[model samples]
Every structure is written in structure tokens, then in C-alpha cells.
Target: MAKYKLPKPGELSSSINYNPPAKDWMDIPVEFKPATYPAAAKEKDLLTVGFPNAHQWTPEDEDWNLPDGWEDTVIKGIEERLSKYRSFKLFMDVCVRCGACADKCHFYIGTGDPKNMPVVRAELLRSVYKRYFTKAGKVLGRLAGARDLDADVLKEWWYYFFQCTECRRCSVFCPYGIDTAELTIMGRELLNLLGLNINWIAGPVAACYSKGNHLGIEPHALKSNIELMIDDIEDITGIRVNPTFNRKGAEILFVTPSGDYMGEPGIYTCMGYLMLFHELGLDYTWSTYASEGGNFGFFTSNDMAKRLNSKIYAEAKRLGVKWILGGECGHMWRVLNQYMDTWNGPADFLEVPVSPITGTRFENAKSTKMVHITEFTADLIKHNKLKLDPTRNDHLRVTFHDSCNPARGMGLFEEPRYVIKSVCNNFFEMPENTIREKTFCCGSGSGLNATENMEERMRGGFPRANAVKYVHDKHGVNMLANICAVDRAAFPALMDYWVPGVGVTGTHELVANALVMTGEKERTTNLRGEDLPGKEGNE
Candidate 1:
């Protein structure tokens, strides 16, 4: 008998009865529209920066201009990666299908698509592994839940794999510790072999390869933008802070996502860094060369991730700094904590990162020698080093959105919240399940933040926005602060769409506003130039 029996069309069914579950994997079909894919990687963007494997193609057309024997390329690529990484092999073999991780996926939960289920998404790749590598699948075929690789399977792989954000939320609930992100990266690597990549990912990666930063901002341009920020700092604090660039013998080298220097929420965070460093009189220099802490190639392939990550350590050694201090970012920290030491290590040229201002040593990042900005600020608050007036933020009610990577990948949970609480008296957290280790993605991570996939982003982002709505209604929260660049860039749109009137901001922006700078005029406006709650009509 079929495990699932359908009710007759237009017929009423028992309202309180439980439905049967599917017994066969083949019973489902997966398909997606063109909007589900990222914008096609442009040849000009790739060629301008001379990215390897540069090709001319768009997903709008049927023929992808794939190289000869592309099928052999993907299958062989999988075979090679399986042998190289034992984690891949073990993850491929062990799965009891108890379904603990199935419901944990945001894509599956939001869209209700079966393929978005984490276990099923991994099975798309594992089924092919079974057919080619395992004896049971080779003999039993479909009955053993294995299928032959073909164009249809390849298409399905691209559609579903790109849907994932590599957030690793499912792994937290899995019994066997099966991480779907590992499979997502592997699938992307194999797809890259065929030159199948999204434009938002490939473009930034290519720009970072040649220009030394994403958005292809040049050396003098980075300085110009920074000087503009400095002008703003002087206007507020009556202090003109000047940070060095590529200067050797500095005590520390500060690296953050290139997005920080750009306008909006990120630029304010950059100002926060500048003001805090000036307050402590810290010795540090910025590098126009290793300007970007984020690695978009991480969204593409591991080898590319390593190549981009190498510049940080190389620049540190060149500048003769003690250690590296990274700014507000999500995947940037993930790479630093999980993969930086492994990919490019022996940062023996640098000393351990100890907060000279607070005297706190980051033991978690001792091996990699990188410290997060929030960690540094939290320590200062713990030691009561900063003179802060939390009442400056009395006009706003704040809530925090834990960006997916730092929450799940690294478990760096409490540092940012501690800093926020120390600075703002009116802070509220979202629902318990919607935060911390179980946080939802901004719906546009892993380089899927393209306009073409806005619909998909909206669908995936609904879960997080829905949680924000709950708190906004309950706690009257008008500010939704986070610590990631993508969160700052993407949350504004998500908030506007799902829960209007909720503004997005970086954690440091709040910290900077509440700080009391010495010998400065009495503050009347906060960072965004909004009037201080009760300090209105002041000069």
C-alpha cells in the first residue's frame, strides 16, 4: 500500500487525523524558476580582474557554454574531494534518517519545499555518491534511494544548493553531526569546475583578487572615503582622528570588511571603530592592500577562500604588527575562527591579540591571532574603561538580530549583546528560539544577496522578520541592531517589507553615540544625527 493516501479532490477530510508520511524518496519532484538562481556571473567583471576559469555565459539561456565532458568533470570532482576530505566521506556514509534536522532548515520551514529540508538537500548529492561508489546503490538502484547522475540531477543540485546559506543551523540539532554546509561548499566547488557561479559572488571575488578589495575600491579611493568619515568624527567629538595606512611597525593591524568604508549602517560602524581607537590612543594601522576582512570566495570554493585570506597574515607580517583586530562582520569571523589557521596559518610573525585598552586576552582566537571588535569593546565595558551615558539612547528601543554565521559557526554569542546592554538601557531580545545558536539568516548570505533572488530572500527572511514583528509589537522596538555587514545591508529591506518602521543598525554605532568624549561640546545628536532623547534644543 502507498504510505500516503490522498483525499479526493474537493472532498472534506478528518480535521483531527494525522497524515501518513512519504515512504519513497522518488515520490517527490524538485523544480525552480529562473528567479531562484543568482544573477549570472558577467564575463567583463571576471575578465577585468582576471579570475581563473573566466567564461562567457548567462543562466537565462538553456546552453550554459559548458566545457566538453562537463559531466565527467563534476562526477570526477566529487570523487576527488571525497578522498581528500575524510569528513566528506563520513558525512556521506552515516545517516539514520531519523529526521531531527529536517524541520530545522529555514528554507524548508518558510517555503515548505521538500528539497529545502537539510537532510534531503544533502541526499541530492549523497544519492549520486551511492549510485557510483556504493555496492547497495549500484545493485538496488532506485529502491536503495540512489539515482544516476544526469542533466536533471545537475539542475536540481544547482537550484537547491544555492538556496542554502551555509548557516549550519541544522547541524545543531542533528544526531550524527551531519553539517549540510559541508555538502553545500562541495557542491559549489564542483559547480565552479563548470564555471557555474552567481554574479554577486564571482564579481566581488574577482575584484578582491586583483584590486585587493571588494567593490574594486582603489588605494587613494579608500583614503578619500576614510577622510570623509574623519570629518564626521570631528564634527561630533571635536577630535580629528587620523589612522595610518600600510605603515610598518604598528602595534596592531585592523582589518574589516571593505563594506565598512561605504555609506550607511556600515560607515557608521567604521566611525565607531575610529572613535573608539582614538579614545584609547591605540597604536594601529590600516592596510589598503589587505583592506577586506571578508572572503567572498568562501561563498565560491575553499581554494579561492585560502588565496584571499592569505593577504591578511602577509600584510600583518609586512606591517610588523603584534596581532590582527577584525571589525564587525559575519562570514569574516567564521573564516578566521574555523578556517583561517587551517588554510593559512603559523601567524607566528604576530603576537597574541591582547586588548591593550582593557588588558583582555582573547584565548579563543589565540592560535589565529585575530580579535573581534565586539570582544574588545565588551572587555572595555567590563573594566569600566569607557565613559558612557546610556540615557543618550533613551529615545529608541533596541533589539538584536544574531547573523547566522557567528551565531552557529563560531558560537561567539554573548560578546555583542554585553556591549549593547552596557551602552543602551532599552534593549530587548527576540523570541528564545529565534536567537543565539538558533538564529535565522538575514535570508541573503553565502553571496545570494542579488536582486534577482529577492523573492527567495523574502521567503527565507520571513522567519527572522516574523520574529522581529513579534518583539516590535510586544516591546515597541524600533531599532534592530546586528554585527554583520550583510545584516546591515539586507535587514533594512527585510524590515521595510516585513515589519515597517523598524530600523537596522550596527552594534558599534550605538556604542559610539553613548560614548562621552573628553573636552568635547555637550552632545545634542546621536550617530544618525537624530536628537538625543532629552537633550533636544541644545547647542
Candidate 2:
């Protein structure tokens, strides 16, 4: 149990101040106020992944129990990373302090904390880089904006780095294209070296390392969970969906975030997958071994991310499936698009993905050999492969939230909208600035979606919620649709706090809602068991 409690919306919104104070940002010391941040990683969770200096500690304590020569470890880690990644080095060296990205961060807009500005957040690390690595800093000191790395500075790094969602919205605006998310990644990596990780992130990393999923769900439990969803699909549509697990010789190996296996609204999306696959008669099998598509290890370090990501290709080869089909997850697609091929390799064992229903070859994913679900569904809609009745979802006026990673990380902009519009009749976009590549984060991303950090999540999500409020007021929007599992999990709480009447949903859930399955009984309700607009009286 945590000490933090969420405040009333009025009080919470009133507390924010967007303007910076008269004092310099450097002089503003880090504060460990209760409820503002998440708890420290437990020793057991840290030990599960063999993180060094694993010990019980709290951020509020005066002594953080850092290992001896911890400063040397962080400095060496920075040096090694700077040499290994050219982009990191370029980001460290090329910043002109132009402030082009200052206002782009959601946290800066919500909380008005100057350090939350992407530029200042990077400077927290860049200043340390200057003091230890740069010659100019060795001579000029303060004039060069160099600062010593001490206990306070390390605490500041932990405080601010976790505040970032690593959405890359700021990078989209940077002239030098500085990825502040990468900087936060580096900061978290350095922190993990000292076992200074939050429980939400460290727990999932450890679970995914050993149990193949973030929830630590075992093979049997994973099967049972999907089985439960199968039963629900039968009740709603009067058609039982039989999905195989860990079955070899399947044409496609389907992978989705484990949240979709059980979490609300996400499970409906999972039901959507089951319904759609049955309709197409697609030869796909679910893998308990590669049960998770979302990677929390990506938030920890490069090595950990690689270690967890290696499972997918390994399962694909073991099951002898062709190319993989990924579900509606944000960072998962980012990892698959950018890092997986580089970390895991050419995936030469897998063939380029060709949709069995539409026969559309995904040339963009030829190297990774994995296709996003929206890309597959959009192709089906484009080819008129599936029988869709958009009127089924007429009760809901919907708006699309372009998830952070998919939009900016992979440039997956139009595919999901195409799918959503094809399934739901009343489709509306969030304000232009808030959608597509320049979209805002759900604030709970990058492993910050913990109970104790509720205040920060709400504050960081304010800009996005504000935009939703805009559409809600004007168009009577009732449901928020997105592709990310994190968005599915996070936005329900976000909308409840900010825009109460609006509900959160997945794109595939919308697809399944409108999908007219063959031999299905007379449908009285949507996948969620809610009656359709005109079917309410019939039910």
C-alpha cells in the first residue's frame, strides 16, 4: 500500500503553475514530496533481474544507500554509451539551447515545472557530462554550464528522468532532432546500474525476464485467461472462438500485450482479434512462450530490452510460423520497428508478411518480418475482404488518440484511423495539433503508470485530456479509441478524472463491434455486452 491519494479535479488542476520562477533552474533543488513520484524498486524485484546494489531504500530517506564509487559507475556508463550510440553522442553535443522543444513536453504544460521542459531535462544529464567529460567544462566550470555529480544530482536525475514518458513529441519539434526520450532512457539506464529503479518498471522487467509476461502469468494461466475471453465471445455473439496456443505449424504467430488477455476494454479488443481471425479462418496460433508483446525492459536498459525481445523470434522459429502479427501496442511497435531487427537480427528464418486474407505484402516490415495488426486490418478493409456493418457502433460518437510511440516512433498515422472509420460511423479526430505525429502522451507511459504516481500521471495527461474535452464538448464524443494497450489501460482512469462521460476503447474492438461474423446469432449487443443503439429495446 502507498501513502499517495489522488486529489479532487478542481484542487489538482488549480495546483499547477506553467510559468517558471525568477530563480535559475539549476538552483532549484530536487524535492521528494509524497505522492508526486512513485516508490523505489523493491530489493526482491531488483534481485530477480540481478540488478546491482539491490537493497531496500526509499527516496525520502536522507541516504539512498548508494554503492561505494557509484559516481565512477555512472560516469563510465555514460562514456560507454556515448561511444556505443552515435545518436546519443550527437544529442549530447548538438544542443544549441534553442528552446524549440521547451513547450512541447506534456509534463511542462501540465505542471509548469521548468525542469520538465525537455531541454532542461536533458541538461540535467548534459551538465554532468560536461563536468566529467568535456575539456571546456574542466576549465570554465559554471560558465560552461557544468555541474558536479553528487548525491543531490543523482537524486535529481531519478526524479526528473522518471517524469518523462519518452514519447518523442519534443524530438518532433527539435531543429537538431534531439531525442529527449533517448536521454531519459540513458538516465534510467545509469540509474538501474545503481539499482535506483521504480517498482512499476523493475517489477515488469523481472517478470518478463522469467515468466514471459509482465504479470508473471505462467503457461496454464495464460491459456485459461484467453479461454475465459473465448467464453465471453460465445455469450455475446453466440459463436465460440477456438484459438490454439503454443501450436506449431501455424501460418502466423499472433502476439499481443498480456494486458489484452485480461484487462478491461483490452480484453474486448482481444475478443475482436478472436472474432476477426475466425471470420477470415486465418491460420494463426497464440504462443504462451511469447505471450507478451509489450516490453518494459525497453524502459530499463538496452541489454535487458534485447534479452526480453529475443523471445518473439525464438518462439516464431520454434513454432515454425511465417511472419509475426503484432497487436495494438504502442512501444511494442516502436521496439519491433526500430530496435528488434538490430538487437535480434535479420530474422531470415521468417518470410515477409503477406496477409492471407488480402495477400497484401508488408514491404515496410520486410526486415523485421513482423506486421502491425492495424496494417493487416486496414488492408482487409481496403480490399473489402471482411463484411463490416458500421451502423452497429452508432450509439457511440468516437475520437481517435494517436498513441505516442506508433505515431512518432514508427510513423503509423493513417492505418489505425482507416480501420476505425471503416468500423465506426461517427468518427471524429481530436484537435489537429493533438492528433497524428504531434500527439500527446497518456502520461503513464515509460513505466510510470503506478498508483502512487497518480497525481503526476493526471498532471502529465492534462493536455491530452484537455484536447478530448474539446471534442467532447463540441461533438458529443462518448468513446476514445486508440491502438496502444497502455493507452487502453491508462486513458480509462485519465478520462474518468478529466472527461468523465467518455469511455476508452481499442481500434480492433471497434472493428469487431462492426464485424458481421458468418453463422453468428442475431446480435443484440456490442462486444462489451452493451446493447446497440436500436437494439436496446430488443435486449
Candidate 3:
């Protein structure tokens, strides 16, 4: 029952210069005090009396030395590079300081902090940029609250920049469409350049660079995992199927995320891909060479992103595939739809995927002529190509959580919803503002998937869970469905914290679970009418 105040519709502007009186210290709320650092007694009581907890931590050890030449060169380089953009200039010039973006931020809403305002959050980096790069800032010095490089400022940048999930929820309501997400991305990229990346992100980035996949799963491990998933698919569907691996000269290259190969939720979606493709008699190959489509580099640097995406093009070329199907992933689709076509691919050898069943052409499809699995499935259902049992998903009442990357980054709203509705009869929707483009984050997207930020993650998850709680109260939404791997990896933890019984799963899991065996397995009164062999009326 969090009360959220919406911004007055037409009042967004940075230049309005309307300032409220400073807070009266006498009348200040006790809850509004800054969180004090915990004392030694509190820390000792909280600490587990174990071998690891015996070691004392110091402030000097807590803060590391600055990178070589960071202050003189790298920092200035980023400030200069980002300064040249008129878009960045528009962002600086147009934000009306109306605080329209204030309550819209989950971090602010959860913390009730005025400084966590999206505009104020961007100011963390924006202030640095202004001080170093702008004329007004150069002349004014500390008057504009800008300062030169110091360890403290850099540390603050690391903290606040990472606080942003880059969900773009704030940008949706911005009058000038000023994206704080982009600023946060730039801030993170700049910090990453100085070797300031968080452990969780740095580990994955390094793993992606050296090993063709993140999670450090090697090619053989990846193949074995895929094989295991294929076995599970067979166990459930009673269809003995081997999903092709690294098959040269295949007509289509299905590029799923490494997460699907390595983790749950996504792995189920991977199995669904195997079943659907096998049913359609499609010729496709899974390439270990281009094992990952989920790029963390998108949250970091564009250059590093290109380095990551180069694999997709390289693998497609090596396999000689006509098209590559991107699996159910959010950022992967964002990179594929927005940047991959232009960044690292011509994909000249590929053909625009024409539905062989309908003769409809997929045009302007940039890299490897990509098609989202949901879109492909929806089109098949549209053409009366797949025989499905719409009532199979009735056991679980489901609500769709449209991932921000797919919903706003790409206009992929209806396709997934259509696929969901076609496969599951009892599908429900959350509040309108909390779905589609206005959807809140699962609190772990855009690299906040870091294990270190559990408390922050819960705070960020508040808005989405509040929305889900409302939906569950009214419509009994038993499970939350989304396509993003980050969402899958993140929401279960949040559900455990906020609403104990509620569950989260991939969209494809619901579809694949509900898939009719032979499309006529004796339609029952409830859900699980004609599911796989051992799955009927069972968990």
C-alpha cells in the first residue's frame, strides 16, 4: 500500500527555476535522517563468528589506489568524448528540474529520498561532465557544485551510478525524452575504463572476453548442458530430439544466451526452443562459438559491446547459416535490434526470414536476420501452423511482465502477449502502467544482477512487487512471466522477500509446459489437459 504521487502532467521543465523553501529543521521528520554507519558493537553482533569473520577490515584496504594516469588522461578523455554530443547537451539544457522524474524512480520511491530523483541521479555524472566540459562550469568552479577528481568523488560515482538500473522508466515521462539511462551507462563505462567495475560485473565481462561465454562455461560444458536440456525436453514431450550443435552449412543459426545453457528459467525457455523448432521441422544449429547473446557490455562500453557482438557475426560466418534466431532475452534483443546490425554485422550471407508457411517477409532485420522466439511462435499460430492446447496453462494463473528492453527498447509488446494468450487461456494483465513500456524492473536488470546488492535489490523490487501484489489480490496472479534472463535470475529472490507464495518463470516455460501433445490429448476440465507424459496434472 505505497502511495505514489504522479507528476503534474504538463509541468516538466528544467528552466522553470521554481525552488521550494529549504526543509525546516524543527519540523523535519525523524525517519528522514541519513543512515548512520554501524558501530563496532552492532557490526560484531551481525557478523558470524567464523574463520572468515575473524579478519578485521580497514578503511584503507576498503578504498583502493586510483588507476595509472586516471586523473590526467582517461577521465578527461571520457569527459571530452561524452561532451561532444548535442544529445548530451540537450539532456543538460532541457531537464526542467520539475522533479517529474523524482517519484518515478524505484530507488527514490523505495528510499523516499529527494536526491535519488532521476535528474539528481544523473547529476552525479552530469555534474562531473559539466565541470570539466562546459563553459559555464569552467568559469564558475565550486559555485556550480563541480569539483576536480578525488578518490571520494570517484567512489561516489561508483555507488550512485550503480544504483540506477538503467530501466528507462524515468525517460518515459521525461518531457524532452532525456534518458538518464544513457547517462548512467556512460558513467558506468567511464568507471569501468578506470578499472572501477564491480566484482560481479567485472567477473562476467572478463569471462565473456576469454571464454566464449559468461559464467565461464566452456564449449564442451555448454554442449553437455544443452544435451541435458534436450533430454529433459524428450522426457517431458516424449519426443527423442537432439538439438543440433555447431553444424556447418545449416540454413539457420539459433543463438541462445549462455544463461539459457547455464541457468534455470532461461534453460526451460531453451528447451521450449528445441521443441518448437523440432516440431516445425526447421533446419537450425546452435553455435558454441557464438554462445551468448546477453551482453553486459551494453551496460558498460559501446566498444566492449562491439567486441562481444563480433562473435555473433563470426559464428554465423563460420557456420554459413542464413539466419540466426536470438533466444528469449531482453538486452540481447536490444543489442540485436538496435546496434548489432550497425555495430559489427552486415550479415550479407543471410536471408530475411520469410515464413515458409505464409510467404511473409521479415525485412530490415539487421544482424543475421534475427527473429525473437515469441514473434516466430506468434506468427506460426497466426498462420494456423501450430496445433496447440490453449487451456493447458490453466493450472497456473499467470500475468505478463513486459521486459523494459523488449517493450520500450523494441516494440515487442504484442507478439509475446499474443503468443502467451494463444497458448494459455487464463493469462491476466497487471496494472496498465506497470506493464508494456511503463513496466518496472525486476530490480536486477542492467547489471544490478550483482549479488552484493541484495538490500538495494529489494528496495528496487518494491514497485514491481507492489504492482504484482495488487494484481494478485484482485486477479490471483500466481506466477509472474517475463522473457528476460535478468528478470528470471532476479525476481525469485524478490518474491521470496515480498510475497512468499508468488513465483516467477519465463514466458516460454508457460507455453512449453502447456503445449498440447499431438494437439488432442483429451481436453480435461482444468489445466494440464494434454501436457507431456508424466507432467499431466502434476507439478
Candidate 4:
């Protein structure tokens, strides 16, 4: 049985005012109407600033003043760095301003401001690039309205680009197929160099640098926590789930976010994996040394991100694991599938994974033979490898909330859905706009998942919660199923505040419910074919 902890009343003070007679940050009245766009006036229209750009673009403003004697060196370094990728230059040269993607952003929908449109968001970064790298800016100077790097422009970059969740939702609707997420990433990287980084990211970045994980839990602490979880599992099921720690010569090494060891919903998923692996008798080891592969540093700088990724390969080499398996995570999978193969690995010792049961090979495998938990589970089910009872999940009227990272960032559109379908019968999907490749964010994504960003979260979270509210009202949907650990950790608070009584659960939780026995009485359906298995008083 799961342990419960009741929340104390008013335990943590909120910065945003949520009630009438609003006090400081806690109770401000919500503006139900959408924000307005900047209205166009008479100009030659050589440069088109969108309607909502009016708020952020102060044309009267002066350029940023560089620190003494560093301006030329900084400019030259930016040029060199920008030159490394031809794609960045291709992205910059390809905007026609057709306004096709204006309504495609969750932030734009929530705010109703035209500038929050993904096109405009990309423009914020592109304009700066044009000024610094192009011949027109260097010769025309002030006449071209492109100036040197200044504190004001850096501040604007921090404010607007960081608002982007980098979900790649914008890419689908762009006529030119521009990806604003890439722009936002590059913008954040440049800002990190300027030392204007957000505190939430900076804290995690420093922690990841010094302590090997974003949460700063050392190797000893990670082992201790996993051991506690293993003990709890054994005590519940009388099944020993031994996860080898830092063991050399293991066939497989597993890595996950440190949040899985420390946080609630994530920990439950951790238990589910442990239970499943024990049942399958898989050979794997967990390394406290490379406890995290989800680089929060990726949101800040490439140098720090490269360093973080380097640790995963280093630890894998030390363990001599022929392959690695990724836990159910959002950005971690994206980083693994998209970059790790080229960034830090050429693991000549490792080969593509083959199903032990079917003898079929994963011909398209990337670095260290990484696979998401859902794909593994779905494959196991396909091979008829596990015993499951779907009736155990009748209590949950669940719908899948495809996490933005895995759904859109990586092309993992089918695996999680396959896992959900195999394990539960009561599953449903949210509306098409809020599902799969078109899914909305959990609001506090991209390292903004902090108590300090509560107000901003509410502002950003409005659109996603509104989508959920529509489904709840229409179909009485009560539960959300997602795969990403961060979505599970962050969405609950948003639901509690905006749409009261709704709950979120990870996809693995439902899987565990169907399989694992917790030493408590198991629910049984009464005859007459009624849905009474998990009715009241069962717990």
C-alpha cells in the first residue's frame, strides 16, 4: 500500500494572490480575457514587427553597453560559435512572416498576444543574429536599426525566449518549417554566456556541474534512496529486487533523472520499473556515479551540457555495460535519441539490442542501445511475456496526456499509447489538439519547475489546464496519464490550483496497479458482471 502524507494548511506561502481582495502575489484576480497584439501603423515595412511585438520592442531604447574592453572579443566569439552550425544560419535566413503559426502556441493562446506567437518568438533571436553577423548591419549600422549587443537586448532575449517551452509544437504549423525551439535554445545558450541566466536553471546547472546530478544528491545518497525503495518493494511483495550499484562488467547500465529517487510520482514509477525488471529477471546495474542523463544544463549552455553527457559515457565505460536503458523520461530520451550517439559515444563495444524472446534486432538503434521503458514494456506484451490483470485498474477513468518532449521532440508517439492500451481497459484520450504531437505543456517545463515561478506558471499553465478542463467537463475525465517524470512532478500543483479535484498519474503507475501486489487485500469483482473490483472500502 502507498504511504500517504497530508498537506498542512498554508504550509508554503504563494507569491500570486488567487482570491478576492488580493494580497501580495497570492490573490490577484485572473484576467480571463486574452492579451492583445500590437496594432500596425504607417511605416515602410522593411522590417515587420508583429502586432504583439509592440509591448517588448522599445525602438527608442539604446544598445547594450559591454563591460570594459570585452566588446570586440565577445562579438568575435559569437561569430565563431554561430559559424559552427550551418543549420542555424539556414534557420535565420528562412522567415517569410506569413503569420501561419500565430495561433499555434500555448503561450499565445493563454496570453492572446500576437508577439507570443512562435514566429515572433523566433524573430526575437533572429533579429539579434542579423545585426551581429550580416554585412547589412555592419555597414548600415544605426540606419539598419541593428546595433551592438546591449544589456537591454539581452534582457529581452531572457524574457521572451525563455517563455518558449521548446515543445516543437510551433514547427508543425510553420509554413517554412522553422523550429522556434531551436531558436529558444540558442538564445538561452547565448544568454548564459552573458551571465543573465535564470536562477532556477543556474542553481541546477551548478549542482549538475559539482555534484553529478541536478538535485545535488551525491552518489551515496542515491544508493541509499534506491536501497530504501528496493527494501520497500521486497517488504510488500516478498520479492527481492536487487539493483546492482556501480558494478563493473554489467551487461546493461540504467540512468534516470535524480528526481525519480527523490520525488513522489517519480518514485512510484521507479518502483514499477524495479518490480517489472525483477519479474523479467533482466541483468542490469544502476550507477550512482552517472545518476542523471537528463541534462538540465542543456537549457543553459553547450559546454556544461557536453560535460554532463560525458559523464554518462564515462560511467558506462567504467561498468563495461554493453548497452544502456533509459528510464521513462521526457527530455532525457530526447537528449539520448537525438544527440548522445554523436556527442559522447561511439561505443564500439556496444551493439544494437535484440529481443531475447523473438531474436529480432533493433536495426535503427542509437548510442548505448537506449530504449524507453514503454517500448520495452510494449515489446514484452507483444511477445506475451508478462502476467497482467487489467480489471484492477477499473477505478481510474484515465486519459493519456502525451508529454511535449517525448511526443514532439522525439518521435515517440506510439510506444506510450501501446503500453497504456495493453495494461488498462478504461483508458481514453483527450481531444486531438491536446493529444500526441499536438499536446500542451505542464506549464512549468524547461527548468521553470520551481516554487518561485508560481505566478508565471499560472500565466503559462492557463492554456493547458483549460484544455484539460474542457475534457473533464465534456467527458467527466478524472485522471491524466503521462510518461514523462517531470510532467508527473509538476502537473499536480497546476491541477490543484486551477482545476480542483483533478489528478495526474504516470503511465507506469497504472501498469503497476495492474501487476504488483502490495501485501494488502486485492480487489475482486463481484459476480453479475458489474464494475465493483476497486469500489469503496477496498483500500
Best by lDDT: 2
Question: How do all the candidates rank in terms of lDDT, highest first?
Answer: 2, 1, 3, 4
The digit string of per-residue lDDT tens for model 4 on 270-344 reads 877777777777778888878886787778656667777888878888888877777877888777777776788
The TM-score values for the models, in the order shown, are: 0.93, 0.96, 0.84, 0.82
Cα deviation at 207, candidate 3, in Å, is 1.3
> Which 10-residue span in candidate 2 carries the lowest summed lDDT?
19-28
Write model 3 residue lDDT over 1-539, tens digit each, in one string: 99898666466565476875477321222221122111111122112111011223222244444445676654665656556666666786677777778788888887765556798777766666667777777789667656566656666666667778888889999887999888788777676555555545545666777787667788899888878877666555666666788999888888867777766566877777777777777888988778888887676677778888889988888888877777888888888998888888687877787665556677646434888888777788898887777555666678888888898888889988898888777778988888898888877777777665687788888999888888788888888888888888888889888877788777777666656645333433222123433345763
Q: Which is the leading candidate under TM-score?
A: 2
lDDT of 2 by residue, 1-539 (tens): 88888799999988998865678777888989888899999999889888888888999999999999999999999999999999999999999999999999999999988899999999999999999889998789879999999999999999999999999999999999899999999999999999999999899889999999998899999989989988888888899888999889999999999889887988999999999999999999999989999999999899999999999999999999999999999999999999999999889999999999877899999999999999999999999999999999998899999999999999999999999989888988888889899999999898998989899999999999999999999999999999999999999999999999999999999999899999998898888888887888776
| Higher-lDDT candidate of 3 and 4 | 3
- Candidate order, TM-score descending: 2, 1, 3, 4
Model 1 bad stretches (over 4 Å): 1-34, 44-53, 537-539
TM-score head-to-head 2 vs 4, winner: 2
Clash count of each predicted structure: 0, 0, 4, 14
How many clashes (backbone atoms < 3 Å, residues ≥3 apart in a chain or on different chains) does model 1 have? 0
